[model samples]
Target: MNEKLMFRRWLDLASQNILTRYFEGEGEGSFAELPVRVRMISRFRWFMLAVFSFYGLAAYGAYQHSGVGFFLSSRQSLVLFGCMLLVVLYNTFYNFFPDKYIHNRRLMKVQAFFDLLFVTVLVHFTGGDVSWAWPLYLMVTFEAAILFDKRRSVIGFGFFASVLFGFLLLSEYIGVLHFIEVPFFEDHSHHTPLFSFLFWIWVCMLNGVLSIAATFLMNSLRHENREVRTSRESLSKFLESANDLIFSFTPEGDILYANSSWHNSLKYDLKESHQVKILQIIEDSARAKCMSNFKRVLEGDPFRVMEGRLVARDGSLIDIEGHLTLSTGPDNSVVLWAICRDITERKNAERQLFHLAHHDQLTGLPNRMFFVERLKQAQALAKRQEHKYAVIFIDLDRFKIINDTLGHAVGDSLLKETASRISAVVREIDTVGRLGGDEFIVLVSHLHDEEDARLVARKLLKAFTEPMKIDGNEIFMTLSL
Candidate 1:
């Protein structure tokens, strides 16, 4: 299964609940609002269209009106119109064209060149030395910051500024554009051509200063945005790979988030439901206890833990140990983040160990220690019932003689057969225990008289007398009662 898709579904549900609470009691505000795909697409389209439209309108108005001597001539106006048309077409049809065509690196380079060419034409159309087109260099710097790496963007901006400066210096030297003359004295006659050169130098310095400042600010903002995106990506990756079942819940015990491990262990389809309460998914007995622990954590406790059973989808029980911690949000409300581990195997191992400790491994009957404990309880009950009881201790007669003649292996086989024969003669209410080698104990309770116990013991003795054949040898044995 795709784990990332599962996690995102959980987060979407959690965000819904959070938004509901945040807007609670405010009429018509209870509904959660998630940005839809269509809204995102529309916003992007509108933003790009607005930016290009605004620049196009401004250039067209400048060409038509010569206010402040910033108007372009016929050739410059035609170039500006062509550049604006290209921008409009690119933004409008980029989504329609295949991504390979729209995002071609060669095409981008061509667009950038045309953009610079239009700016240069506008500079020349106006008075080259004194035109306000110098401020339009901000657009070039902005494009560089958006479209290229920091070093490349800086280089692009520097190159555009150099070319524009060179054109301005050439125009001033060739007398194509009248240079501004600064009066060294209050008399016009004392003014020299050196004054005009100094004035142009000041204009150049101002243009350089403004362009660099705007570029630095734009680049800084872009860098900050990149860092934020990187941090978010790293956090998302860490959450997806985490082993523990991490979750958050409401104060009322509604589930907010459940990690992949939780769904896999419980075999539940968490994605199918939007809001699941803890009690709905957990076992009945554990529900109250789990909710209590959740409350304690939500009441500002840093850490609280509880162990209980979680019901799986197939109605089987799973042992779980849960840890909870309270986290305070920006709004001063409490949120419970919990981590749980499946302990089914550990619990099963513990039960198996307990069973092994009390029962005999060979015969699957009670061992000596357990028999003694049961005997004490039985003796107390027998006293209350006012019944006669007898403890029959049995030993296999000449058992070692048989072992020495045949082998201990044969002796062990005979002992096992003897125990089974004795057990068959005793009542179900009676207790049987193997004390040690060749010795066994039987506690017969609820007997009417001593004769009842004697009959059982005699039967056990007779049963052993029926010779047992081991390793092709016929052996006879007796039971001591």
Candidate 2:
């Protein structure tokens, strides 16, 4: 069993070695530079040499009656071995040279022509039509299919093999060449015409069919390869033409690639792109968060959607939102990839909506809801830090009466003037708001004492004591505190 296993292993290795060039040596290039066909041809020659040596040695041993029943007679084997040796010596010149003539179909056809003739010789010595060696003719045709670029060349070689095989069989049947049948098998040295005809048909059909099949297979593979290359190019073009900022970075924050949108927005050219880093474009307020998220993803966390402001070329910040993908690059290095959309316009729209929700539509002061939230925030601060703060409330006396008699235009004008006066009286850290119907509130922070609040209230009342000119109508508005 061990010997059987070892023999099987040897056969596998030998077959792989012989076919290595056919399967792996053919590379992408012009036909003239396709070096694999050269290697394949050399490998085929070497394999044939090994077969000849093995069979010749066996035939020599059988000449002494000590070998297995698998070899031709001693005289026949000697002649065949000598001829094959000359062929090998002739092939040696080709092996030592570069494969510059592989593209030359005439030279390739010549090689196939000689190879078929030698295979015919192998069949002649080993038993002519009845010899298993006849199958080598088909293998030669297959080799031609691989080496020749055109299907017509392969078919031509196959046709040539059929002619050589037919001549050998017919000559032996008619006694032109002495028929040598297999010694181990039943001898058919004087085979009938019908048997010779049938065997010749089988050999020719196999060679022809194998030739067509091999070429078809090669063409299909080439078509598939072209399709794959085209698809890859299409995807590359799509990435370059996309509107969103697509980018990739290394673990050290070095920029690997940035699409056209990213480059144009950052105002970095192709030449300067290599010098730009990911952190350089990150808004300072968002840098720490961005780095933290990057570290988390590097440590095996899933991809994260990062929101940060990117500094543009004109010193303006763009709100960018994207998901970061962590992948292992070549040699297993960490790569951070992102496809971020510039959300600056979207963020600006959201801010406007927020302002409309929280501020007065007319005067742009904080509305009732916003003022209450700030009051609570101030209340929490005062409690936490013992901070002094106060809230002052004021209402315009008989403001509705002015709206009913002099019209709402004058009433709106007076309200607008009052909001500005109150805002002007408060500190920058303070909050001013309107509660509608000529009512307003102020949040005063960092106060010294209760007396400070009274002083601010008095300052506001004295400022409003002067009449406000609204729509060219002077109206004295008294505040009810």
Candidate 3:
């Protein structure tokens, strides 16, 4: 009994290990069932359904061929049917009420025991000496190997085979069954009791070979499946934990899937039904444009990029740049897998940098560097077109005196006000630049002549002559060109 218990425990462990390895290797979301109890119940239901259906068909066929009386006479058949029915009942109820048997180790062991009993009955019914039913023992051996450790599976096979052989010998000795006739070297004339005994020996040898082979094949398949599952799971983990907003959309512009970053960063949940349309999140005008672009991509065109504004859930707008590539499926259906980046901060920073690089930081006028580059380009264009351009350099008169008396901060404020005044006088085509402290330059392009430049400079000088308030002190300066 201790030995039997140990063997049973080993078998259980091995089967569980095989299942564990298979499930772990398959990949994430392989099993639809979440709770272990539910998964166990479902597995039990499936197993019982298959086993019972096979047994039911086999039993009905046997009764039809052999007659009900003959079937009833075979206690093996009765026992097998009864055990199969019990398995079906247990599994059905366990599926209905998973809490009862899902975690019951003792019940599982009993089920395994019944499985062994069923196999024994099958063996007896088929005539045990090298019959087709011997393969059924291999099936039982495989089940044991999957459920338990290698040692336990081996032990279980040996012990069960011994029991079967013992029953065969006893039944034959008591005349309950006849010993099968065996031939010698395929010659019926040479057949003898010795040949019969040898044939039985051969049956025993074949049973061992079949059991070992089945166990090996099942174990290898289980290991391979486990590896595949594990790899898939690792990949799923990476996708779920990734930082970038990973998402895919159908060619119809319906969102198919999105990772966690899409939900956390964009505050968009794809799992919801109302949010299925990708266009729903985009502004109406932009959505139409995007759809047109996506159509081009779906028509077997290569990768495309789109930049636009995305309105957030809170009604705030965010700038997004998406890099979209077409993923063609085996059936030639196109999918757009896009990685969208929030470029709001980057766009704002770029605009700020543009302002700083082109305009004077203090006075909001174009800086000398920007003025020089633009002037050179404009002058070349003007010369080609037989047009006129004017360049006027202005220096503030007695500006150093104001800086020395009223302080440089006051002088700087005055200069800034003076710049604003000059900017108002010039046309949009004219460019005003701050050369340095107390110095300014203006570029007038497409001008009639140098007279237009002089008139603009005179207006700027008169605008600055008005008494200017600098830090609550009045200061006056003349602009010299």
Candidate 4:
């Protein structure tokens, strides 16, 4: 149990080291969340499978040519089978073991050394460096470039492989290890000893060039990959912490992704809005117009400031102003990217300012400017319809006296009450405006005759008969038309 625990701790530490080396400071939601060691192991597993296939085919070809079972005969042949089994066992252990070493550089170095030794034995028994399996040495050098930190390490691994090959060739030339006569290279083996030795050494030097070149190329690719990951990390941090609502949607209006600000502004949790439709956030009355603009944007039009009311999770409408852009995703699918800013407070302030400019502050009634515009509109309608409309100007009697006696607070309350009473007496279609202090205008449009205006004036007069209660005091008021 202690041994198992120790192995687990070692694996965990190894994985953490690999992550720090490859994925540290990577952006949120990046592929960096996957363990680098696990990714390396996954790639290495495929390399092992390719090696297995190559060796299996070589053994089958040997058996077909020699008319002898490759694994059943000589010690070298048995060792070849043993190497194949080792590859299989290693892959299986990596898949099944409770504590597997992943991207463990030290462990890989040891395995690579053993592989070099095993290939050297195979090369010696199969008539030295002319063996077709010589290219497998380059594979180890490439793996070294990917797994190690420097180009020197890759070259060192390649030199180790070559040295083992050289020692095997030297042992065979000196007759220290008996060279098994293989049928395939029988013609090559009949060459003079001196020429054969020089040729084999030359072949080893040629393989060293190939190994070095492979390492150089692989290292360049690794450098490029690291740069791309760094750029991605930087971009991800910017998007994740941005205050604007940054999100993407599919062409069909389905929400594809949303950032932290989007969730915060919309008051929806990440999981809750996973499959939400983009149009669902827009106010019902504005959706048709918004969708039209969205379609236009997707059709290659540049974005304009699109103002819409978005319904939040709490069912409050938020005024949002932003633009949408069409961009292709990493997967080459067209997506509509959006960056919307919350302008609810700004919009509310604008409405309040507009109200202040056009309406009375105390009475909540249209001021002089708005009342004049309404009067013009009413006159235009009356002229178009060939009808008469009456505009009755009113001034409250004794209002200044009441204001002076009761203070400005009571005066403001009485003004509000007067506006409400005048509003109640007028028809919904008529305009009742507070023109100025104690001055009002009632525009009765589409009236049939002068008598219709007098009846509305009578109603306004009677509405003031009920005394207004202000500051716990009932106060009487009157207005003249």
Candidate 5:
């Protein structure tokens, strides 16, 4: 390829989105607007095309009338039209090119350069040293403040505008270039060469100052507005890394966000949680307590710690102990946050320990310690109501002989059968317990007389009359009370 072809290929491959970058904010921590920014820049391109087309038509009309009202000669009008077409050509070229991040910022700078160059031409043709179009320079400077580094905006746009405008005015004043005079505006060409130099210096210094001021002011406002975005980002990252279940919910019970630990422990899909209400995840038995706490949080009475049961996605209950707090969101909406540890295994272990301590493991019957407590309660109730109560201590006869011959397992089956038989004959309010090996006890209360106690004892003795079927062996046992 030749040098001209290589240069043309380079220009065709270039693409930029300065307007998009400015709207999205220029650098780090600037996401969440990428998709919206893309569409905005697409519309801005059409707007720029409309502006170029409008000016092109104006120049074309002037050319047809030989500088009639627009004060454009044949050559100047063609030059303007041709210059617009150059920008249009590049703009059209970029439309067909795909945009992606190669991390090159030069594309924006190059586009800005072209814009400044084109505007310089317009400033000179419309009015020179006394140009009414100087505000156009500040407009581009404002854009530079947002989309480019502050230091670079000062040099690239501010100093560069001064150089272009100064060169144009100085050239025209020195008679090196023809100064086109607009019809109504005073001819600045007749002004002294020193006046042009002094005007350039004034413009140059002012650009530097205004560019710096605009950059700082814009940066301050952008940082202030970014507080919400930064807070959300920090919360997501910090909460997600926690081992405890962490979550946030709206005041209306809608779950807003849940960390990975929360979703995993609950067996819930994070993506589907938007439709799941906060109280819906709590176990049915615990919903009332959770709702009470939820209301408390809304009322600014959040708890320091609480115990709750959460219903998992698979309909299993999970015991959790945690703390909940009320918080204000970026939109000033009230929200609740929680950090909970899974206490399911620990709670299960506690229940198991209680069962073992107060019940007979082999017979699955209340043991000596529990039976004694019930005896004390029954004594107190009988005294209060002036009723008689009786305690029967029954021992199985020949229990040791059965265990030695038929084995301990068979012996255990006999004891369990005995407990069940006794329980069936007694009133529901009565207590039956296995005190120890081959030893059982019963509590009979609300008796009318000595005759009532005798009747219950007779019923107990008859319960052992039937043979017990244990481990496919039949055995007869008698009880002594």
Candidate 6:
């Protein structure tokens, strides 16, 4: 019993080795009910049955008529036909109930070995060196090459087929096995023994060489195909994971492809993005300028960074900086490719800095620096156009006394009210700015005469006479011009 168990273990290991030798990575999926090895075995079994059926009918018919197609005697031909039929029936049953037996690599290897062994037996009985079934060995070699993508497997199966055929010839020649009759072709049997043996050896070697050559060519093609597939997958992943908005568009402003960031920035979902036109998201005011830039880029001009506004889903505007390029589309026509980065925060910060430089943060009015700049521009205009402009410098009376009597909050409120009152009295072309403390300047430009400045001064004085309200307190204020 122990010897039997040991023999079984060794047999199972050998069977597994044979199966894996031909089908290394064909099908060993981790998340499936059936293994790929079993499926391949079933397919190989069906393929063998088809080949056998075609040859069996032809050989049996030839044997029954006059032994013209096959070299086997009538009894031997019948036996071969019966054996082939039995194998076909067995495979058909196994295919119907694959779960009945162990459908694993080990079992598949045993089935494949038996399949070759039977073919070898038929070859020996039919003709040995000159058998019509010799092409079956090439079929087996090609099957192994396709199933196993490795060079070693293809070369191994090639050499194994050659060795098996040589063994059949040697066994019969040395009397270990016996041939009942010569081949169906009578004239070939009269050849010298040495010449016949050499011819058979040559035929076996030639089959091995051809099998190896075919395997090498097929393996090269498969390798190239895999490399191309991997490169395409890598490029797709890069596009999906990019941070900037990357997209392709037609010359007619139709969007073709948009990546993850592109859809997300525009507040569009995957399904909605495909239907959106490229021009729809652009701000109405910037669309014409943006399209002009797009046309220039499409005309093969060098690309440059562009600034524009994009209207978001919530009806808010987002400032974006973009880079554009041109490429061939699916129809070989010119298409535009663009990468847009959200620069909304950066643009907001820049606007804030400009406002702070020229305006007072407390009263939201133009500051002293802006007043000086406006005065210089007025001086230049008066020098050039011979037009008169007046700069009115006003000071609030007793503002310090009011601030000391009340808290600073009331003073700030009073200053804010004073700024508003002064701004209200100015003309559209006039500039009003705070010069720190209670001093303010009015730049009245393009005035017709000195009387216009007096009218503006009268308006400014009348604006404070109504007793201004400051933080729920009615405060009387006066200013001197």
Best by lDDT: 2
Clashes of each: 0, 0, 17, 0, 0, 0
Per-residue alpha-carbon lDDT of model 5 for 91-116, expressed as tens digits? 56444441531134566566667767
Ranking by TM-score: 4, 5, 3, 6, 2, 1
As a TM-score, model 3 comes out at 0.58
In candidate 3, stretches whose alpha carbon ends up further than 4 angstroms from where it belongs are 1-81, 93-107, 125-133, 149-169, 172-361, 377-398, 423-431, 443-466, 476-481
Worst 10 residues of 1 by lDDT: 29-38
Candidate with best TM-score: 4
**How does model 2 fare in lDDT?**
0.81
lDDT of all predictions, in order shown? 0.65, 0.81, 0.68, 0.76, 0.77, 0.76
Superior candidate under TM-score, 1 versus 3: 3
TM-score of candidate 1 versus the correct structure, residues matched by position = 0.50
lDDT string for model 6 (67-146, tens) is 34444567776777777776787777666766654434344444445566777887877667666677777776665555
Q: Using lDDT, rank the candidates from best to worst.
A: 2, 5, 6, 4, 3, 1
Better of 3 and 6 by TM-score: 3
- Candidate 1 on 72-173: residue-level lDDT in tens? 456655766776676567545533542433346454445555556656655655444445565555555444444444555555565666566566657766
Q: Give the range where candidate 5 is weakest over 10 consecutive residues by summed lDDT.
A: 31-40
Which of 5 and 6 is the better model by lDDT?
5
Estimate, for each residue in 149-219, the C-alpha lDDT of model 4 and write its tens digit: 56677777877777776677677767787766655555654545776577667756866786678667766
Residue 456, model 1: Cα distance from true site in angstroms: 30
lDDT of 6: 0.76
Show the lowest summed lDDT stretch of 10 residues, model 2: 25-34
